[model samples]
Target: MFHLLEKRIAETFASCIGSLYGLTVEVQTEQPKHSSFGEVAVPAAFQLARQLKKAPKAIAAELLSAVGPIEGVAAAEVAGNGYLNLRLDRGYYGAGLLAGESAESRMSAEKIIVEHTNINPNKAAHIGHLRNAILGDTFVRMMRAAGGTVEVQNYIDNTGVQVADVVVAFRHLEKRTPAEVCALVAGPARFDYVCWDLYTKISSYYEEHPDATAWRQETLHAIEAGEGVEAELAHLISDAIVVAHLNTMWRLNIVYDVLPRESEILHLKFWAAAFELLKERNAIYLETEGKNKGCWVMPGSAFRESSGDDESKVIVRSNGTVTYVGKDIAYQLWKFGLLGKDFYYRKWHTYPNGHEVWASTGQPRNSSPSFGHGSRVYNVIDSRQSYLQDVVVAGLRALGYEEQAANSIHFNYEMVALSPGTCVELGLELSEEDKSRPYVEVSGRKGLGVKADDLIDKLIEKALEEVTSRHPEEPEDARRRVATQIAVGALRYFMLKYTRNSVIAFDFAEALSFEGETGPYVQYAAVRARNILRKLEERGERLPDFRAELAREAMARQLAEEDCWQLLLAASKAGSAVERAVRSGEPSHVARYAFQLAQSFSNFYHEYPVLSEANREKKTFLLWMTDYFRAQLEHTLAVLGIEVPEYM
Candidate 1:
């Protein structure tokens, strides 16, 4: 409701300014620092001050006079130097809320592809991987909430060096054959966990015996050859690990629409098609000198300004193997339907909710839902890959897909680190130097990070203890379910609260806390609202039909109370919050809004006596407010991929 009103007001101001000054400009609205000033403030007059050669105050007065009345707006006035302040019609807004009016914007016609959680199918997912998935998943939810057609994709690097190293571990170090490895994968052992340890062991082995590094290259070649025991072992490890990854993500309610694997990019000759484009367009040239000699390279000038050094990126090595970025460019082209080549997809997994996830294959399968060919793409990778992402975009531009290149978004985020306190909580021995530091970075090579499943299990165990203490009479199974919900809420919220660029230091206590901006705190606020309604039901009273009981006049009288008005206004802005967050490309904005909304409801709950109010009209208004708050809270939590438990 707020978003619609804000949009209308901005358009009205733009139109008014065009009429008054004969000049066109984009108009933007912001919330005033204090509610007493107004609900929305415009600084268009200041923007026009120099162009008009007049005092901003006079311009503001002129625009205010020229502007006609806006719907849902009570009054507009010029304030300070050049600001236009709008006060909304409280009763009108409140009545609309009572009617269950939707604030959703018009649906976007473009299909948006969000590629995220591209964890290499080598080992167990860690906390850093969790941050990527949660950020990407929440952004997808935000876009969908704003009426965007979004497709969630998880890219699998099944044929990468990470996978090669794991294959080397199984064949060379562990001395296991293809049949033995297959049996191990099919057995009851946690395959990803097993590969995690093997990956670490292989890394140490490489350090001890430098000659063993050749084992990796040999394994890579064999895997690329697409035949032999080595290739079979690679497929077995990656395929099973991918399943483990999906299961881990599903535990947090993160499901994907498709899984695009690197193997398909190779087996289907995607790079071959891309290589021809680069040659035909002169996007890449073979280097003849310097360190990049005998390799196909994209000059630095294509992606970045020259710095007087040979900074060209190698697209293909002298060995005729395409680089990661080379494959990425082809994948990006495929996403925008510019590659001309397409992948054969097969059903891979069906989530419990019946959402199907398809995987790219080398051979044709039965008819399946169309994948890729997106108008826009968002690759949710870490900030470390920004340079590679730039090169990929430059590749598209060089190939004359400038519009597609512009639409290629790199949703980069900082890595997650473990806080010192959390390290101790997890029984990780910290060095004296590390103990003093604020956070300790996790290294997959060193096997020095918390696995996603381990962290989740730990959170649930801790939450279950708290749940049992609070509601000891509840059934053990019920308590466990609620505990799981709280655990997920805590983890997802912890991952989301930080801005994308901000590195999170994961701490269990702070995240799982029942107070102070935590997920459980928000969940408790929603639970409090539900309890109010449940208690009323227990008293043998039915909820009043708010639409019938709360007329415009009654709404105005009830909303006249400053506290009531503020609470209702806050609750009604969830759509506005999501829209703003989507525009800014920051999920933290929505997270911040959720915290503020929860705080507002918490204050309202303490001050208002909804069940015991003597005035019937005011009581109905407060009840409506409670129900509305609960709905908004749950909706926001769902976007964040967090769940509210049946009980606090």
Candidate 2:
């Protein structure tokens, strides 16, 4: 149990060393490092030793002796490195796990908002955008598993320079008006793919002439004011391209609760109100002197490594227009409920997951769906923007809303780049500058990247080949359905496997692998477990249900015996893994848990006789264990945006 382990450790530490500063042992969960080690481990002794001025060995010895007597611990031993390692009572753990009471009972629900996948509406999505959506969506699922209320937001840059650039391309380059483009969009050629090409051409042309930047500025104003022809064209472009983004994300099983547009942020005067508040409090001041004359500034950003936190940054420029930093500060404050402002929201569409993708509008409605005022806001962005995001939080503190600032998070992730071979596969001829670099950059400005949908198609096609090879007799529709799930698992897990800070050098061949340490591997494990249950059902031995069977087996005196320890031990640690996975914001725990669950099931499968066993009671118990893992693993995989194929 999550609480059981923590409680047992707390009792042991408190009872043995009550004299040692009364430091409570709130948790006994392992800080998972290498897999060769057991499922759970603790280094509490090291900390206790440092605090108590005792040798770590002696403290571990004391703690192990003190903790071992507590229930559910199969063994508690001090490791050679002064780490206190604890193993669970397996049969006890596994039996309790099957009952599902442990995790259900140990949860405190809190609301969390995860905003991600704010892909610019100007072009087709790429693998870079995939990383953001995959991670954000997975985190939302994980929070719910931990008994938290999660609100998923997908930010849309509908009025940004990127979208404006696309508008410029259609009007300036091709001379097509809004109505002409709308009529053509009703016909064949993919609207987003067309926009992608047009947007890229405009980007390249922008490099040739500096004066072209004026069109972008004018479009931004027109977008704000809701002006004529070009704005209508922009609206048509944004609407059609968003459909493209949705289709691509649907392939990966990612969905959003809301889609907030940047235009609404401006039109609603969100930044304007936030600016007034900052100016009133002197959190930001009007700089009438120096090169920043007539501009407003927020004195310091938190990420200025060696600089004092009290330093300031500019909020408004000399032209009286809000800078990017100012807009972000306003957004962050609104997210945390510090800004006395709100949006007029309209339901855009219902996403696949049964949640509404509500869009914000400038004018207030008589009644609208609630938005903003989150207790926590996690902005899933790339590491490059960490500097600016920190300033958002800093601005809050500067205005005396320390709690709001504390709740603002920069959930930074590294950029995705293409591997050399995969780069060439995209039909780009390599030059010295390209081949010599370790990885290829995905430049959105130049449109040099693999489209997200294209990658999903490739992954699905490859999976289809493998699935058909093994199940050639299956119906075409059945195979199609299974292929989609496998492709999703492959892509989602591939996106999550690396730590957020590590660069993902995207490789098609590597990501498509169905073998070890992949999403397909996790799916394969669950599929095998499903097969066992199906086979058992065919044999007329119905799979022992979750609790009824486990309750019956709990009476068996063999559970008190030493040999039953391993199964219980494996079962008991699920809660700990659940807690750690969320606490650390890492999916590897879920990955490792899925692998270990499968591994344990396999070992039990090999060791225990089910249909062949003479001991009907023990066979029933074994089935209970198998069913327990099957349920758990399926749930865990679901959390990672993975599906367990029935036949695969």
Candidate 3:
């Protein structure tokens, strides 16, 4: 409702300026620095002062008289050199909110593809992978709330060096045959966890004996050739690990529409189709000299400005193997439907909610739902891979898809690190040198990072202790359910609270705290709102019909109080907060808004006693305010991917 008023005011002012000055200008609106001034401030007169050759205050005075009455605005005044301050009609605004007017504008109908959680199918997902998935999933929710169409994609690198290394370990180091490996995957132990330790052992062996790297190269060839025992081993390990990853993500309520694998890209000749286009356009040339001799390389000037010392990026090595970026370029083209190729799709898994996830296959299968051909694409990756993402976009531009190149967004975020205190809590022995640093970076190659399942289990265990202490008479099953909700809320909120570029130092105690700027703090406010409504029912009294009992005159009378007016205003901006967060490409803004809204409700809850008021009309108004706050709190928390527990 607030966003709607702002738009109406901007349009009215833009028309007034055009009629009076015969010149068009875009009008921008902002909130006043102090509430005493007004709700909105406009500086359009300042923007046109030079063109009109007049003082800003005089111009502001003229526009103030020329502009007609706005729907929800009560008065328009000229203040401070040229500013236009507009105060809203509180009675009119509150009435419209009660009538359920929408604040979101309809977005474009074009489909947007968001690809994230591209963890390699080699080891268990760590804390770093959680950040990527949570950020991506929350962004998806925000877009959908604004009425935009979106398709989620999770890319799988099943035939990469990471998977090859694991295959080499099983074949050479562990001496496990195909039959034995299948039994291990079917055993009681977690397959991803078993492979996680094996990956570390193989990495250590490579350091001790340099000659062992040849095993990786040999395994890579067999996997790419799509034949032999090593190829079968790669499939067994990667397929099982992929299932494990999907299960882990499902626990957080994250699901995808498709899984595009590198193995399908290889067998389907996606690179071959892209290679012809690159060669015809001369995007890449064979390097006959220098260190990259006999390799097809893209010149560095295409992606970045040349500094004379810049080196060209190799697209295909001398051994005729396409580099990761080269294959990624093909994948990017397919995303926009520019490449003249398509993948055979098969139903991979059916989630409990009846959502089906499709996977790419080399062989043709039953007809499936349309997968690719997105109007825009966003690749959610880490900040360290920005260079590779740039090269992929450059490939699109060099091949004449200028519009697609512009729309390819690299949604990059910083890595997640662990605080020294967290490392100690996890039972990791820190050296004196490591203890001096503020945070320790996790290394997957060394198996030195916290696993996602382990972290979740620990959080639930702690939350259960709290739940058991507070609700002793409740059933054990009920307490366990609430504990899971609290644990998920803590984990998801901790990953999303920071801005995309800021590094997050994961601390267990800081995240699980029920006080001060934490997920549980925001969640407790929601639970409190629910309790107020529940208490009313428990007292043998039904809720009053707000629309019938509290008319515009009654709302105006009660909202005259400064405190009541402010709380209602804050509760009405949930839609506006989500729209702003989407435009700025930041999910942290929404998280911050949720925290602020929760704080406002807390203040209102302490000051006003809704159930014990003496005046009948005033009691009904306060009850209505409580219900409105409860609705807004739940809506905002849903966008942040956090759930309020039954009790907190």
Candidate 4:
């Protein structure tokens, strides 16, 4: 109701003022801090006073008289100096909310592409990667709720140095043949966990014996050339790890539409096409007289602050090998349909929700769906890659694809660390100094970070302990189901409660709590509302028929009371909160809104006794409000990717 009335009031005033004053104005709104003031406050007269060269007080009086009656507004009055304070008609607003009707659309129908969870296939995903996947999936939910056509892509870096390092480890350190490695991958063994240990071992060897680093370059060349046993070993490692990643993400309800592998980008000659375009447009030139001599470099003047001595970014090395930035530029161009190239596709995996996930292949299948060519692309990566992201956008602009460059976005975020208590809970050894610090940084190279699966298992175990203690009579399988839901909700909400720029120190105790601003707390409020309806049925009384029982005149009479009106008004802002969060590109706003809505419901639940009320009309109104709260809370939780369990 709040989102509906705000748009209706803005449009109505815009139309009214344009006719009377011959001035076009942008409508702005603010919430009144006190209940004595009107619900929606607009300061339009202050904006128009500047153009008319008059005091704002005089302008407010004139516009209020001429604006006429807005559709759902009961009265319009000028507050203090020039603020346009408006009161909503209680019957019309409450009836519309109960009916689940919304105003017209506020967004365009353009298709958007969101790329996230780009975990390297060489190792297991850690706590940091969970943050990226949760943030991306939640944003996708918000965009779809706002009427957007969205396609989710998870880019796999299979041909990078990370994959090559594992291949080198197997061949040199472990002395394994291609057929033997393939057997290990196909056998009943956890291949990804094996690679995770080998990756760290290889990192330590590179520091002590510097000559061993050449093996990385050699393995990379073989992988890029797509020849020899080393290349086959690389493919085996990456494919197994990719499957492991998909399974881990599935536990948290994260699914992708397509997987665009970097190997296909190399095998299909995407970089060659991009290299030709760069040279043709003078986007990159060969460096001659510097430390970066014999390398194709993009001029730093294109992206950096223009100084005569700016450093150039190398795209291709003197050895005729393309750098990671070069491949990234090509991938960005393909997203906008500027490159005259496409990837061959094959179905890879099918999710439990009946959605098929496709993958890019070097060899063509019988038929394929066209991927890429998105109007806008959002790449979810860490903030540490801001420089590379800028270079990719600059490469697009350099090739005269200005619009595509402008549409590309880097949805960057900081890293996740572990709280000191969590580190101790994991049985990790910490020094005295480390224990005193607020958070300990996670290092995948040193095997110091918490694995994603390990954390999820711990949460489930902890939740089950609490669930069984509360409901001992529940069946074991039913208890397990509720525990899984609570664990997922706790993890997702903990990741999203922080802003994008804020670093999170994840703690299990803070996330699983059901008393404060947590997912379980909000979920319990929803369950409480549901139990009210359930208990009424158990007592041989029918639930309120909102359509037939909740008449406009009855609602207006009950809503005239102070507490009833406040709770209804607060519940109506759920949709508006989602719209604000979508526009701001912040999921924390939605998390905060859910917490506030839960808080309001808790207050109303304690104050208003619906079942024992003697008056039928008043009881029906309270029951309807309880149902309204449940619906709004469920909708908001869905947007956050948090599911409410039936029992908890």
Number of backbone-clashing residue pairs for each candidate, in the order shown: 0, 16, 0, 0
Off by over 4 Å in 3: 429-436
Residue 432 Cα positional deviation in candidate 2, in Å, after optimal superposition = 1.3
lDDT by residue (tens digit), candidate 1, 1-648:
788788889999999988887898999999988888878999998899999899999999998888988988998898987888999888888987788776667657899999999999999999999999999999999999888999999999988899999999998888999889989989999999999999999999999999999998888888887878888998999999999999999999999999998999999999999999999999999998999889999999999976444878999999988999999999999999888999999999888999999999989877878899999999999998999999999999999999999999999999888899888877888999999998999888888788999989988998999999999999999999999998888888888899999988877677666568888888889899999999999999999998889998899888888888888889889998998899989999998899999999999999998999988988898899999999999999888888888996
Models 1 onward score TM values of 0.96, 0.90, 0.97, 0.95
**Which residue ranges in model 2 land beyond 4 Å of their true spot?**
19-45, 50-68, 74-91, 103-109, 287-294, 300-314, 545-568, 602-609
Better of 2 and 3 by lDDT: 3
The TM-score-based order of candidates, best leading, equals 3, 1, 4, 2
Highest TM-score among the candidates is held by which one?
Answer: 3
lDDT of 4 by residue, 1-648 (tens): 688789889988888889988888878888876778879988888898888998888988988989888888998888888888899899888888777778655778887999999999999899899999999999999988887888999999999999999999999999999889988888886787888889999988888899998999999999999999888998889998999999999999899999999999998999999999999999999989778889999999877877464478999999999999999999999988888999999999999899889999999789888889999999999898999999999999999989988999999998898899988988888989989999998876777778898788888988899889989899999999888888888888888889999988877677666567778778888888998989999999998787898888887898898888988898888888888999999998998899999999999999998899899999999999998899989999999888888786
The alpha-carbon RMSD values of the candidates against the true structure, listed in the order shown, are 1.8, 3.4, 1.6, 2.1
Q: Over the stretch 7-88, how does candidate 3's per-residue lDDT look in tens digits?
A: 8899999999999999889899998887778788999989989999999999999999999889889888999999999998
Indicate the residue-level lDDT of 229 in model 2. 73
Per-residue error (Å), model 2, residue 522: 0.7
Model 4 gets an lDDT of 0.89
Of 1 and 2, the candidate ranking higher by TM-score: 1
